[model samples]
Target: MRLSGGNGDERSAGAAQGRTEAPAAAIAVTDLVKAYGPVRAVDGISFSVPRGAIVGLLGGNGAGKTTTIAMIMGLTLPTTGTARVLGSDMARERHRALHRINFQSPYVEMPLRLTIRQNLTVFGQLYGVRPLRERIDELAASLDLTALLDRPSGKLSAGQKTRVALAKALINAPDVLLLDEPTASLDPDTADWVRTRLEVYRRERGAAILLASHNMPEVERLCDDVIMMRAGRIVDRGAPADLISRYGRDNMEDVFLDVARGRGQGAVT
Candidate 1:
């Protein structure tokens, strides 16, 4: 089925404006920093994700990925610098843009006693989605959650919860999506299905996606560009194939390894 919205006319208008009137990046970070006491979780990093693009954020544990995502989502205040989403400063004006963005992560949980349908209803209402029941039904069917809609959210299996999280994220047909390990806990086939749905969403909405994942193959498959983070800093970034060639590696996995171990051109420091 077609997604909730489309940006075709916006794209046409942008094209008509020519090179001098390029659209603003859907997500932009400039010298962004977040610190806790003496610890810097993210340090002076900058990047942009254009509309209709999927950009992967890759890093190991304690590498600042979660903190960075939090700051971008306006859940955490940055120590310095800026994060802008759709032309609004996330720190000071996130409310203006929050309705147009959504985030998903397997780690977030819904109330144990709430049914999946109930949870979706609450979120849909919060987002002011018109015809809420129809939107919920659409997402349930698309995410294969129709059979489990009345199940208590906490009782669902890990894979089921992941799908529910995705449905929640898409309830408002967000223009910007932030995903953390989007396919986690699912079987290979299910994971592939989820990726395909994400691709469709991006294409249908001209959305910008910022994905954080340790799955090298998934990153290689879904991302237009990959940003590598290590110790609160970006050590490398490029298209998967370009990074592979630059590091003389056969695939993204090896390239990731090289960076993580400080072995190649864009080695960790």
Candidate 2:
């Protein structure tokens, strides 16, 4: 079921040698800004993710969550400010910095014609994975993709597709994982499974993950810290439970709703 094509692994492995961990901060941002004409997409944002931690980026639509992620990934150049990944400045050393990081989002897609295994092979090669077959097999088993290995990516159900997408992201054994709605459209059981796997991956690799999600429970479960945003600005940042206790709310959802509506104060601390 493997798609025969490309020599990405050599490049990936070479890149890995050059890849360094982000020091104490897996990701660092300071006074970040991005603009689309008059609209300020990200307004003076700053945050840091520690190694081996799961941090959640939470906000309603247009709150600058995606914009911030894009800047971190070096996909969209910032209008101003600094971003660093794996301790390298994202703006100045993106090529060198990008190799250590990988991302997954439901909105992104693998080639529709490619089988699950084929897609994994392609990405594994891209990551310069040594022993690519073993890497793919490991990921497939961890992601529960063994049964769907031969299925065309385009033909799979939402849950199955998510699993495949996750496999693609982890194929390289990246140091920093960026996930945007990793469990979107998944049933509860599937979502829970994905969360457990992510937890294990973080612990095993000491990799940092920055997750952007709308599922409050998902964020609460998977993230050790939560950053809440509104109108492209971070309104609050704290542990999920801390925020809940601070606001006297039952859970993370209530805190999210209050921030989105601007009915509550920003930053509990």
Candidate 3:
């Protein structure tokens, strides 16, 4: 059974409370829709990420995950509906949200010629992060980029690039962080390290994070909630453990399997 309709069931508490009173959520997307001529890439999707929560956006290829991310980041215009980051309308008032929001994606590579320090410094300046030099040093040390600070970004290995990308993402210490395939190509140890660092960041900073990933175990480990999308619509959403119990599955991977394969009817509560 395909999951249809907007996010009445899947919306966070702040979203459920109504936009007028939209409670200081980290991100809020309401009745959001996107289309490409004959294809509806994202169809009436709505969801939110509350303060300090890590929410996963999970789906297979062409499930509209990319488009959705693009919308929130203000890279693409939505066909209709609003997406607010830190209460600023993304489509029209992006400047207000831009400073407090950052995205990290391996697919979106940085300037190869720039050194690790150079790349991060550029982004930090763009966000107007105060005491920029101090912030870069702080991130370099925290993300283990101290040794690579002088190395050209393009000269680094894939895993090294991933780590640098993460450092760039956190340069501004954004209140809202969007990550796509964060651990996609990392080995087991590095991926685990990245996950642990993310957990620590959220706990200490109370930041809201939207993680778009295919790694099921990673999702189960870090996310406080999971929003499953299929064919551009949210099909199932709840805490990872709740979804597992509801679907009678042993883990998030199995629950994801059931939703992706369209196993049952009326998936939303």
Order by TM-score, highest first: 3, 1, 2
Candidate 2 segments exceeding 4 Å error: 1-23
What is the C-alpha lDDT profile of model 3 across 195-215, one tens digit per residue? 999999999999998999999
Q: How far is candidate 1 from the true structure (C-alpha RMSD, Å)?
A: 6.3
lDDT of 1 by residue, 106-195 (tens): 668778799999999999999999999999999999999999999999899877888888899999999999999898778998889889
- The whole-model lDDT of each prediction reads 0.84, 0.81, 0.84
Q: What does candidate 3 score on TM?
A: 0.92
| Residue pairs with backbone overlap in model 2 | 8-125, 9-125, 9-128, 12-127
Which is the leading candidate under TM-score?
Answer: 3
lDDT over C-alpha atoms for residue 223 of model 3: 91
Q: How many clashes (backbone N, Cα, C below 3 Å) per candidate?
A: 0, 4, 0
lDDT of 2 at 142: 77
Question: Candidate 2, TM-score vs. the true structure?
Answer: 0.89
How big is the positional error of residue 152 in model 1, measured in Å on the Cα after superposition? 1.3
Report how far off residue 18 is in candidate 2 (Å): 32
Alpha-carbon shift of residue 7 in model 3 (angstroms): 4.1
